[model samples]
Target: MGVKNNIIAAIDIGTTKIVAIMGEIDSDGRLRIIGMEKTVSRGVKRGVIHSIEDTIGAIREVVDRLQAKSNKNISKVYVGIAGQHIRSIKNRQFKYIQNGVGEISKLDVEEILNENFRIPIEVGEQILHVIPQDFVVDKEAGIRNPVGMAGRRLDGNFNIIIGRTASARNIEKCVKEVGLEIEELVLEPLASSLAVLSEEEKEAGVVLVDIGGGTTDITVYFDGILRHTAVIPFGGDIVTRDIKEGCSVLIKQAEALKIQFGEAVADLVDEEKVVTIPSVGGWDPKEISFKTLAQIIQCRMEEIIESVKFQIELTGLHDKIGAGIVLTGGGALLRNLDVLTQRKTGIDVRIGYPDSTSKIILDEALNQPIYATGIGLILNGLNKPIENEKDLGNDKDTGSKMNLFKRFFGAMFDTED
Candidate 1:
């Protein structure tokens, strides 16, 4: 059994579901999943908490189940946050090195990084994460690490993520009400990338599109640095809504049809195939053609892909994305989504799963895309450096993972019967 102190826990408070997961970083340093619990979310919409009471109730339910499954009390947990109001902007700042002509110390780097928190923003909004994109030492550009480098001044380019203060406060209040403390509020897109993206893909330039129930979170990485992040107000829920209205079916039925029969490309669906939808209030059962359902799904999914394309273009890295697009999240499970995304974007595409790489030990039940954010939260928390405790920026720590990568080829797994 692993030490209790090494048990890392995280909660993914998503729009459609709330997931509580606990893992332990073993002596070998590989992360092993011990338990996970998920339940339907009733208070969050589009990644924002709308009703404190409902969200609090849902959080307690999942947390209680998780504690029982693991037989450990969880106090502090890392949480993931995203929504329509979340946005990111690029900024650059420069500061002179202390005692010119001397080596730049870690203090010099932290000085400029902390200055980002002072950047101007609209009322009622605050910066959430400041990811250092690159560093320029003595006017030399594209330096990732400037420590121990001789320089007169330091210039840091950063991607600053901002969100509504009210949203974050609500999330904190809900978690606190449920007897839990938040370790940090991680951006959902950033966390998702950690789970699905490979070091090679990030270096070669890749775009991650995480289509959650209420919003689609997109993050663009180039030259192994985070370049841009955005959240589209539309996501899987919108597609379900479209199906509900177009096919004249209930929301639950629409969602079920989408999971069981929805297709991203209409041409691939059989025109003659039809599924009977259960009727309500003694009405006759309604039969909808598969092609019609697919057509509705395809139209909406095309919009999403176009939005994703537009976002990639905004980053000015559309042509430089060597690894292309990696789609994940619950919506990515739709039939033939990868094919549609590739054809529409005119770039190679692949569905990203939690086990797409050999980094984390896989729990067969958590291999699905829906659990990416929850799992990534644990990894992100474990990867955070203690030195970052004083730094105001987020996602800047990228050191070796507790010397765990050496066992990548031979992952350690422990599952209960």
Candidate 2:
């Protein structure tokens, strides 16, 4: 493969699949998708690495394929992280401006953000992101950017995302084992929002629901600011498992049936229709009604929707969600899912495709919800600002690689809290 430092890469390690994408920023500042590949995820469960070897194998295979297609050597990559252990909390920090220098500088802002990093967290947990929601200068409130303004005290309200330290360490280990360097670790829901959400939708208050294989990731935005994020343990795989057990079918057959014939609403199905499943060995075929399958799917989907509703209610902005909910990810493609979500939540709902951004144009087959995280990862990587080599580690080769990702973790979290 050709060595190209300008090429940026991202790996989305999902429960059902791992997607690797390579792209470069064009003169027009658009991210041009050059190569992308995906493979069935192994050793990953609910977006967390379970077996490092298996996860590394999957990552290596996808990366190799992406490299061959793009003809670019992959040295480092940005990766997405999500799982049941992910949670968010609101935090506040205050920094006193110099007595003589009443004007707040960028250093003051950084100091407030740095203070968030020092907040006490659970013993086994680590802060993954510290997003500034709004800034307050002295007694003046609702300040968006306090820098360049004069104030005696600067207060920052932030949304901090925390996850199990072991989970993150395992992910880093997987990337290292694959002979790749970690650029940054982005939360999966945030990446999905970057892929599918519009500025208008965010400003009007929207909830981005990413229903992947093993978990349903939720991100809430109000007035263009991120307000809340959560992860539900149940996802598409659990629904498939319900089908497998409910229909007495094999796991593979269950997944295929859910994808091909599943409906989110049982009442929408005709009870007269039946799907025949071929039996294993010498056993006879079993006949199952369309109603039965829909009923099974509906039960699980309703549960998931209720969980989403609970999280939305917790935000206390449920009634203010003017843009309602935008659903993406593999499970969002289910038949009548938008309709079901709308009915359950009593809010406007739509299927979110990763096509909102004009920065990248992907293959028609890859323009689906399943590729949202991967596309967002590539977009994030392309937009990441360059950091000084000194800010990276001390080793020359490793420092340069680490520099590519330092800004993402340090500055990306400076997002709307």
Candidate 3:
């Protein structure tokens, strides 16, 4: 019971929302959400913090509310990270057998992977994830889980996700400043994929598009392997801003209208409908045609979806998405967004939510698409083999004691992560 009570928190710091969700690993190896809070984001845009002070204030507000909601202490967190600066690419690694051997061992596989991490990347880019795509032995090209097969050569194809070193550092600094330990940093889109994507979807191949407040993140998975990841710096904010300029209205007013009455397709609007706007000088309130407002929003959202389509084409993954696309994030909740995406990208689309896997039925508040990132982060750690793992014989003298002789001269605090 004491062990199951260890809380895991996921702080999803997005451009327009700051979320802190607390969950505990119950007896069934599932993350049970005990506390969840989201606050209006400040000094953050396009998933990057511009002012640490304002961001910290937002984080504190959410943390305070989450604590009060669950009466649980959440001091460590697995934060979700994303931004336009993140990038990824595919790489291959090959290792020749040392002795032209009879059998390949796990150590040999580890050495090959360790060398792959040494692949030359830009100085400011830090490797976040190295997902194995497949293994090639001799002439065979698609072999997954190639641990035990006699082969003189071991080769692997991987998709390496990297981000600007500064963004990575900033994520760590901000979370640590909030008196919380950084357990892990999961990319927002990648985390969302983990939360909403099913085994069938992954195996059948799918493209996940997360249209967030300030940016759209894309991830493509084929044959149960991540193939491409890209972060495009455009999202719902662009549409709102376009409305502000296109409709000649205040930003606040434009934002309100965009959410309340905005439509992604202009042709769908009824030409007779009109939305009234309160006049700026308290003069006569002007009534604007809903068709015009819808047009302005449609143009911007259309462009954004165009870019999404381009990404799919760029990856050469347009025809590979057998499961089509999974749309999640604040932007995905936009009316007819899924339909627009399907039309523009020529792929079937659906709004994704963690509710599909969640068992709680709580009046659609926590069920919103906004909770995807936080829930995904929690789901990531929950999938790990933590529970149902009994200790092996003489556990104390096993994994940890292998390097004891080398640790005798150094303090325990000096051990590295």
Report the number of the highest-lDDT candidate. 2
74-171 per-residue lDDT for model 3 (tens digits)? 77677888999888888888887664555555555555555556788998888776666777876677987555567888897877778888887887
Model 2 regions lying over 4 Å from their true place: 1-4, 387-417
Descending-TM-score candidate ranking: 2, 1, 3
| Per-residue accuracy of model 2 over 158-239 as CA lDDT, tens digit each | 8999999999999999889888987778888988888899878888999999999999999999877789999999899999
Where is model 1 more than 4 Å wrong at Cα?
1-4, 385-417
Q: Order of all candidates by lDDT, from best down to worst?
A: 2, 1, 3
Position 148, candidate 1: lDDT: 71
RMSD of each: 6.1, 3.7, 6.8
Candidate scoring better on lDDT of 2 and 3: 2
Error of 3 at 123 (Å): 2.0
TM-score to native of every candidate shown:
0.91, 0.92, 0.88
